[model samples]
Target chain A: MDLTTIVILALTGVLLLLSVIKDRRKTLAALRVAYKGFVRLLPSILAIILVVGLIIGFVPPKWIAQVIGKNSGALGVAIASLLGAVLFIPVIIAFPLARSMLDMGAGIMATAAFITTLTMVGFVFLPLEIKELGKRFAVARNALSFLAAVAIAVVIGVIIR
Target chain B: MNEKADAVANGKKRSMRERIRWDYTILFLLIPAFVALVVVFPDKGATARHVAWEYFKEMAMILPAVFIIMGLVSVWVEREFIVRFLGEGSGVKGVVLSFILGSIPMGPLYVAFPLAAVLLKKGAKVANIIIFLSAWACIKLPAELMEFQFLGWKFTLVRYLATLVVVVALSEVIGRVFFKQGYEVPDEALDGAEG
Candidate 1:
């Protein structure tokens, strides 16, 4: 297993063991909660998988690369961030996708913008966010996140490349 | 008829169940569509299936454990404890704690919404909650590891550092504008979100 998998598994193992040792009853309850939560997570996970398939099957990597490539400039970054906000691709898949785009010649700035907004500002989940966090907080957080993502992207582009 | 009002009266449980059902319908349709794609274009379908299968395997491995840890934390960390740490006058410790809590790699962003709502109701600073949500979205350790694997250490490290500064600044800026006196969370805010 890779470091990510190993570290995650180890962390879970240690924590679960501690919880079980500390209180068997609470541990059991926690297990039940975990199960239900996992179930809740399933639909989104499956949806992302479906999206991954579509992206791979239909969308050309080369086309994406051209749009967001090194010379694609500020327009590319804006487009990438907008697309990032619109889609709800989880980070698990987003990193791989970003890596692929980079390999296909996408600029560092564009990729950074894409990943930042992909994670931070999700318009696809805006309704749910608003439902839970309230209108003002949700809208402001999202709007601010888009700006923050761009700022972070620019910073990374300057420092790294 | 007031559809929105009717929805509130119907209660959140019904909507949550309906949403799950809706998700199932999509999954049901997508499976056949996926199969059809495989039939129509073998090469592309194989590539798509291959990629999907890889992520499915990855998520399956990590998610259960993540959920278990999240469950344990949620069950163990009392609301009062959260309020004490993140409530008014919490200061720098609260921000650091939020980042730590959020960086635990527990689950997806939507899963965080309910907890964020809970924090809001419990008198946590809205700005701190924003930091918590931003950290959950941006720099969870597992995600950072993945970024490192895919993008290398330089990109991962730079982005991680940059994201930290930006998230805190943005939250603070938005906090000043909207939560000058702190959040007054509405009743319906927690309707379906809180446990």
Candidate 2:
């Protein structure tokens, strides 16, 4: 395994061992709790993974890259912004995604927009957000976030371009 | 009967309008992106199968682990515990401690929220939790450092600033409207606090 994976595993192992040794009963109870927690997180995580896979499989990074690349201008930035909000690409995936987009020759503005929206906004998680925070709160928060994300994009575009 | 349905639809429309006003700038931004996509990129028809497969494969295992970890934190943990330990009322020291504590490792944004909710219910200050979560979700000091090494410091810094603003702002707003209404604090943060 890579160093990161190895470290994470080692850490998990150490934590697990410590918990077990400290109090076997508490450790067992914690494991049960953790298991239940795992179930709660399963659906979203799976959906996101599938969606990411589908996006990569279907959209062609080159096409995404082209739309967002350096020369593509404001239109490219808009598209990147939209995609960023809708897609759940985290910072980890963002690195490779941005690199691929760069390779595809996407403009700096588009890339900036993509990066901005990718983290700030969350179109896909709208329903869950609404459920959690009430519709008004979710809608307002996301709307504000989306705008803020775009503003960040615009600033980045200006600086980078 | 039809009038009632229409009224409900109208209410929905109004809500949508409010949301749209919040997002009008995105609409404006879209115009330029459309033009670029149409005019700039050539042969827009090609499919990117390999990249998708690679990303999918990598995330498959990782996501399950994240889910389980988040779930565990959610359950065995108590919200009041976190509030007592890290409430905003605790003052600057508490806020600073909250920030440091929050910046530690966690799961994805979506998974983190439910946990945040639990904390909110448990009595974590709306502002502190908001600040803590927003920064925790995005700033990720250690991880961001890695990103800077790879993607350049400028990108990382800009992202950090923007995300911080968004998180803090949203936290305040949510606190005023939702969490203050007596939502239950998350079990995990509470558990951590107690632990």
Candidate 3:
């Protein structure tokens, strides 16, 4: 297991033990809740995973680089931002992809924009977000995040370059 | 009155059931689509499966633990406690606490949304909740570590600071814009806002 995975497992183990010690009933209740929540989220999680698989499988890294390469400039940043907003790749995978893009001559600004937007904006989960957190809150947060991403990208570009 | 309440409750339950059913249908369709991809383009299909497997393994390990923690938090932490910590008038302390709580490694952004909703239901300030959600989404500790590993310390650190500043500002602005002063949002506001 990776360090993050191991750490999370250890933390969960410790917490679960403490909860069990504190109150067996509550601990069991917590587990039940967790199981229900897990089941509820299962389908969406599977769909997202499948979509990520399709994306990585179909879209070659070389192609990503060519589109967002150094010469692509402002347009590259915009494209990267849009793709990041739409795509739902895990951060673990996204970092490596960003690094690869950088190595392949993608501008630092474009890479930053991609990473920022990918995390901050979630087109795929919009329906869920809207359902949970009010439409106004969800839409406002997402729109603001997109704008913040662009601004962050510009600032990063200026500072790093 | 009792009969009306029961009807409303039943309607809510039916809607929830329908949502779940829709999710199941999507998953069922995706399975066949996945098979077709594998059959049509053997090379890309295999690669896709490999990538999917990697993610599935990761999710399997982390998601349960994350949900359990979430469950514990939801059950053990009283609504009053959350309100006391993150509610209106909590001010800068609440903002800082939200960031710290959110930065802890959890599963994914979608998971955080439910937790954020819970916080909102507990009367957490909108600005703080927004900051919490944004921090959970992007400024997570493990994600930052990964970024540092791949993109170097300078790039990671700069972006992290920038994101923090921007999110806090954005959240405050959004809160101000969406929620006017002296406006008391009812407890049922969120439920009523749903389509």
Best by TM-score: 3
Pick the winner on lDDT between candidates 1 and 3: 3
Docking class of 3: medium
The fraction of reference A/B contacts recovered in model 3 reads 0.68
Candidate 3 residue-wise lDDT, B1-195, digit = tens: 999999999987897898788878888998899989989999999999998999899889988887777667756778777778898888899999999988987667876775676567667888888889888888877677888899999999899889889888988888888864512333332331111
1 versus 3: better DockQ goes to: 3
* Cα-based lDDT for every prediction: 0.78, 0.58, 0.80
Instruction: Choose the strongest candidate by DockQ.
Output: 3
Candidate 3 lDDT (Cα, whole model)? Answer: 0.80
Interface RMSD of each: 4.8, 8.4, 4.2
The regions of model 2 sitting more than 4 angstroms off are A2-4, A40-44, A69-77, A90-93, A96-110, A125-144, A154-161, B1-81, B90-118, B126-133, B140-151, B185-195
Per-prediction backbone clash count: 0, 26, 0
TM-score of each: 0.72, 0.63, 0.85
C-alpha RMSD (angstroms) for model 2: 10.2
Candidate 3 docks with a DockQ of: 0.56
